[model samples]
Target: MTNPDKTGLKPTCREAHRLVSEGMDRELSFVERTRLRLHLMVCDGCTRFNGQMALLRTAMRRFPDEHGK
Candidate 1:
């Protein structure tokens, strides 16, 4: 869906960016998650970015301390 109409609606790319990071850390409200999903549907960059973030997170979890001390 396009940007929100008149009274503060869908998340913008900037907000979606924050949402992407937020989603990784904590549970988002249904409204927040829905807005992010809708944004990702239309924004290719964000979609890919989100995927990459998820992948990075997964890899980190799979291989802890990639940079050994």
Candidate 2:
């Protein structure tokens, strides 16, 4: 998971997971995006996890509130 600039080594799964979450909240640095992409390319679990997070995020965003209280 070398960065676009080839700065550092690949990130671990934990780090990749964090990066995925961070990516949703804010723009990721090139290094972070690269590492996460590389990790997701190989890690099926994390890939699925990322998709699930996206699905859940969308669901929450679209959920309607009925109560005014």
Candidate 3:
């Protein structure tokens, strides 16, 4: 289980995943970004997940335009 710091960031893997997913749709607050960054620094799984999400987001963005072409 991850620990919360002074900023009360939940800092858990679950929270990290939630933040990463949410960030895809909307901008996270400073605290949320900080917490997710800290978690990603130590958790390779979440880091990979973040990267995969980025790749997926990119692919999804291009999917419609490519289909139209």
lDDT of 1 by residue, 1-69 (tens): 634532355567888889999989999998888888888888999999899999989997888575773
Q: How far is candidate 3 from the true structure (C-alpha RMSD, Å)?
A: 3.8
| Per-residue alpha-carbon lDDT of candidate 2 for residues 7-27, written as tens digits (9 for 90 to 100) | 445577778788888888999
Model 2, residue 44: displacement in angstroms? 0.8
Looking at candidate 3, the ten consecutive residues that score lowest on lDDT are 1-10
Instruction: Evaluate all candidate structures by whole-model CA lDDT and list the values in order.
Output: 0.83, 0.80, 0.85
Which numbered prediction scores highest in TM-score against the true structure?
A: 3
TM-score per candidate: 0.78, 0.73, 0.79
The candidates, ranked best first by lDDT, are 3, 1, 2
Q: Rank by TM-score, descending?
A: 3, 1, 2
Model 3 scores what on Cα lDDT?
Answer: 0.85
* CA shift of 16, model 2, Å: 0.9
Say what the RMSD of model 2 is.
Answer: 4.9
TM-score, model 1 to reference: 0.78
Instruction: Show model 3 residue runs off by greater than 4 Å.
Output: 1-10, 65-69
lDDT of 1: 0.83
Question: Considering only N, C-alpha and C atoms within 3 Å, which residue pairs clash in candidate 1?
Answer: none
Quote the lDDT for 15 in model 2: 81
